[model samples]
Target chain A: MHNDIASLINSSVPGANASVVNPPEDGAGDSSVLVDSSKIYEVCEFLKTNDKFPFPVLQVISGVDYVEYFEVCYMLASFNLENSYQLILKTQLKDRENPELQSVVPVWAAANYQERECYDMIGVRFKDHPDHRRILCPDDWEGFPLRKDYEVQKVYRGMEVNPEAKMNFEDREFEVRKKEMEADLLKRQLERGH
Target chain B: MQTWDMGIKELQDETQDESMNTELLTVNMGPQHPATHGVLRVEIKTDSEIVAQAIPHIGYLHRCMEKHCESIDYRGIIPFVDRMDYLAAMNQELVYSMAVEKMLGTEVPRRAQVIRMIVSELQRIASHLMAFGTYALDLGAFSPFLYAFDEREKILRFFEEISGARLLYNYFWIGGVWNDMTNAHVSYIKDFLDNFEGELEKYDTLVSSNKIFLERVNNVGVLSVEDCFNYGATGPVLRGSGYKWDLRKVEPYLLYDEVKFDVPVGTGERGSTIGDCYNRYIVRMKEMEESVKIIRQCLDMLEPGPVIGKVSKVIKLPKGEIFYRQECPRGELGIHIVSTGEKTPYRVKVKSPCFTHVSMLPFMAPGQMVADFVATIGSIDIVLGEVDR
Candidate 1:
């Protein structure tokens, strides 16, 4: 669906590199335009100022860890559906060790807390981000929770975040889980009037 | 007593001298303060009565919801979503369900759609009532709080009857609601809507249009339309900035396209700035009325039919990303779903309105009186659960 808008971004903005992230025939859900990580800031500026279709609002900014690469999604929308309603710009950062991307906060101030949150959850650093500190997590938090390989630390400041202490339950985790599954199946059957 | 009088006299003398500089004080207003509405803490820099800057500190209630959603299957996410904005949990569930339904490309049954619209609008009224009640409390009027919640309790009673929970109703599902509405649910809503206007007009005469309330909030903590959009403020915050934009009208998700309702906006009436605390509060007040109208229309259109579409228990969504936005009671609640053809979502990014609304406090809090700070926060009607989530 975004194939048209992705091609439009390529032709309109000078030196703008953009492509559809997941075209419908090949992928699931709606498609979004993936812009070059380095030039994402400039592309956002263009989208904000472009006369033909001004996406005045940066609706939200989110991050997705694809294991191999970290992808950031910038959701943009025009006020009142002026020309085009929405255009999602995504940037992929292949650097797994220390992922960094330019900040679009300069274009949309809405990107301020959202980008910080993306960093807090996904660990993707935004260059030129004002006060780029952790938004939702503590400053000393170790690993990004949203990452695929994320593991809970044994202790958070000496208090066990992953508690070793266990309650005296009638059953272990999988045992209780099995019972819950059976109950759910029976409930579904009853709801179906079987 | 003499020493205390000398201290007060010195303060009065300092006020008399225009040349005398007041000492700047740094005040931390609640990671626990009652007027803050929740556990939200704002670090305010003030000189005498005027605020110089405010930096809001959040994450006290962070449950790492997005992180948790990665492992949970599609259906289980609803209960978790309901907890995010507990005040407007139906709105939260509705938006999340809509996002998943969009990804699955499933059509919600017509009856299900009507009931969803009914609950969403009813939840809107309930949410605005809380906003009105608590905002009145923040502004130092205790009576309206009682009056507002009295009505809100009635809404909650029926909501409890239908959804089986009072505060966090996980009633809405992906393609349908959990339970079908009975005649009891319909009559409860109708009775509430019937008496709602008389109560609303009483509130209007009592607090919203009151001279004293206007004096406290009229021109205080104003945000222009440009500042509002730039910071991504939505719902009453955006509409109160004199923007007539509502997602139900513009985007028209669910049965919003079929419904007839007017989007209430702030017009700076009664000697107030376009986007002041007064405008924001009044917009929410007017929206409750519009919600009533929408609910009446939806109730008339209601008919007997199935409430759910044919969807499998464990839906394996295809590999793609979807960003869906809807107008919640607080503002625009957006769900960005990244599926990897699995039973569980790879990534579910929640774009909460309070998160953005709280971010802009620094923009609005400066240059206002120190007392008006709570007024500004209350006007936005932030539920810290959603803010931290």
Candidate 2:
């Protein structure tokens, strides 16, 4: 199956290969393979066309964010061969800034909602997706809530939804800023009057 | 935009219109409607009676069961798992147990395996009964629901005697079942199986054989085998499309490999590829009988032994990851467990049957009649709690 997948991916796209993962101890000998993001479509095409590793069903599409790079995983199940495999596609992204990837919904229609969910939570931009709006949250929702650095004490749409302890600190900051702004305004008004 | 009028008398004539095209009307079906079974809303666009498009709106019943499971202990989360897909509670519990067992490498006793097989098959029957009853009502036949409910009550009686509850019975534990059945429970099941055939005939006479029900379900939502595979459909939905793929036979969990029972598959299309609502209905109806056969065999082979394996008071699964899938009534229900060698699971991801089933609706529901849409959804047998979870 690994060789078949390798040949399939190699034949379909240039510079695409499958690397096997060491099987976990005391577990099913299920192997994982890594793929380049640039050749994802070629791999997808190969799986759909080839008989041995026909990725007929897309089980799940989730994003695993490493600090340096983002791993977009696609779990494909082959009914023809009665086996399943995972395709981990990695792409480096700027840290603290959202990165974009092409949508695989065209390859498998089932990936539409899953990708949207990935985008909503992980803040990955799925390029050219139809209706790439936040699915689990409102449209105007800020911050990728699932990100490790995402602050829990965040304000959105004029509502202070964070904890009361944080609210005290935020309130003190707000009062200090308000006083400074008011003093600045008074100074400006006095100058204008002069 | 322009207003047109010839005279006061001529304005009375409403037939003269320029917008000749008839547009598809959008109808929001339910966040509250009865047929939805729960808070599932499908935004449907229709041209008169035929559905132009359908976009299923889920998340209404989303309890975040996956995230919730991570916070609770492994043993503490079993009851909450039962509520996800409330119909096939035993199967839900079993899949979780299978995942935990796979992680721990626990071997359940042969006696317990047989008992698990028996209860799982019985739960399949009960799950199919709910599906069939609700499917009948969706197609405008109320009598079948009543008759099906009546038959289901007998199964519930058996369930109550075994586990103290009717629905949502958290019977299956990690290593084995919570309790072993008595002779009375075994005999009651035998009697129910004996009478199930006669009761199924009542359903055939009341609903399956009825012309109206047949017309509504026969070729309404034709999901091909290719579509079934593509959408990750399993259980009766896949089997109904002529795929002889049963996890019990393929994966052979518990004592299923030892059991001698036929895999009931649909003869799709022209006795081969129909894959329509009727095929799904017929497959489930036949599967109930098949389940009964397995149950009868289990009863004859029943042996007395300890029901549970060596399970710790605190189920601290070894630090590992295991994805266990089982053939549930609707489709494949899976539990992906990531254990950190702790009392609580590190992460729990449930691959719900209805999640895959409902994903196929946007494609299947279009080009179907508005009325047939409900029938098609019912045929899919979606429990929205599972979908939204």
Candidate 3:
């Protein structure tokens, strides 16, 4: 499956530096191929539309920040093929600050929200993406929260950014309430005994 | 008398002409509305009553689950996974645990696999019941909602007995389940399954065959096979388009290959072509019966053995990435994890099914009636918790 996908990507997409990589010993069932970030869209389009490697469903697009660089992984599965085959296509981005890649939404409409999520979390910009915006965060929110160096803001709007506000209850108050309840129970038991 | 009749006819003609010149109206459906199922806001453009277009705006329930995964260890993420799709928390826990297990190259015990199958199937039934009841409520039927919830509450009782939680069960661990199921709980599930068919029959008579229900759902919000693929719609929504693309049959995970069950597809039995709202409803109804079949087989094959596998307490994954796909109740729940030989995951991306379903709303909602819009949203069976996460 890996070789077939590699050959298909090589033959169909010009200037796409694609190569099939040997599966890691602990890697799950499917094999993966490393493709250039610029030609990811072309390779994906060919794989999705080609007869031999018809990976119709784009399952997921996950972005990972690896300190030195960034990697975007695409999990693709086929429904039209004989036995369903899963394929992984990884593209590396060297520029971590303004990472950019071609969008595959024109090939698979499912990429619309997933790409936006990648951008929102990892700060990867997909060129030519329609309706590109922060999906899970507010429009006015600051830095990408998923990045390793992202620091929580002290305040947003006029409210303080305290994590304690999100807690269900404070420890001291809960302890005090428990003591009060125990005392009341002891008084009731003594009265009943009398 | 003739002059009076002419005057009334002329007034009627003028009113008809005015009604014909309709203006487009934009309406907001959610972010707080009960019919949307959760905090989903759909900006719908309509010409009087027919929707010209509908754009869904999500993120009201965004909890930044992926970001949290980066800080928490593999074992600590199960509770967070349960919160993603609160309706099918078992299945959510199963997929996350399975992914982490795959990354660690650990083998799950046979007993644990069987138990996972049983619990996951039960969760499927419970999730479908929620979808069924809520879909009925969306269509203005009040009785079926009560009837469906009555059955669902019984399933929750069974889950509570086994996992000690009614809704969000963080029971499924990375190597195996949190605890073993007793004979008493097994028998309770068996008894529930035995009586479930009768309840389903009652629902069919009350809602499925009712004329008003049929009129509201039939031939409304149709999705073509091409459209389903383009939009990446899965589970019942894709099955409703007459595609036999079930992950259980196609890419059998866990012990799904051992189970005998049918994949129900849309046959256009409700006087409409395949992929309509009615077909999606019927597919879910049929799927519940198949889930019962699977659960019965699992119960027969279940044996007494160790539930949790032998693994290190502190899980340190090798440097690699893997994408695990499970046939979740709503659709294909894919978990993509990237590890850097660390205790915590480098990146964890959950490809939630409802998120894709919500994305397809813009494509499905145009040219549909404003009232049918509710039926369309319900037919897709999206939980906003999953979508926003």
Candidate 3 residue pairs in clash (backbone atoms < 3 Å): none
> Against the native chain B, what TM-score does each candidate's chain B reach?
0.95, 0.93, 0.94
State which candidate, 1 or 3, has the greater DockQ: 1
lDDT of 2: 0.75
Residue-level lDDT of model 2, residues B1-389, one tens digit each, is 12221221233233246564456689999989767767888999876566768888877786656656766788878898899899888989989887788777789988888898899889899989998998888777787889889888888888888999998888889898998989988888888888998888878778777777776777778888888867778778888888887877777787787778777877753332378888888899888888888898899888999999998765777765555678888887877665657678756667777877888888897667677788888888889888777
User: DockQ of all candidates, in order?
Assistant: 0.59, 0.15, 0.35
Worst 10 residues of 1 chain B by lDDT: B1-10
Q: Report clash pairs, candidate 1.
A: none
Q: What are the per-residue Cα lDDT tens digits for candidate 1 across B331-364?
A: 9999999888888899999989999999899888
Task: Give the C-alpha miss distance for residue B268 in model 2, angstroms.
Answer: 5.5
Two-way TM-score contest, 1 vs 3, winner: 1
Candidate 1 local Cα displacement, residue B60, angstroms: 0.6
- Give the alpha carbon lDDT tens digit for every residue of B291-354 in model 3: 9999999999889999999889679887777788888889999988877678888888898999
Residue lDDT tens for model 3, A28-107:
33457988888988888888878776888887788888778888888888776357778889889999779999999999
The TM-score obtained for chain B of candidate 3 when compared with the true chain B: 0.94
For candidate 2, list the clashing residue pairs, or say none: B268-B272, B268-B273, B268-B274, B269-B273, B269-B274
Best model number under DockQ: 1
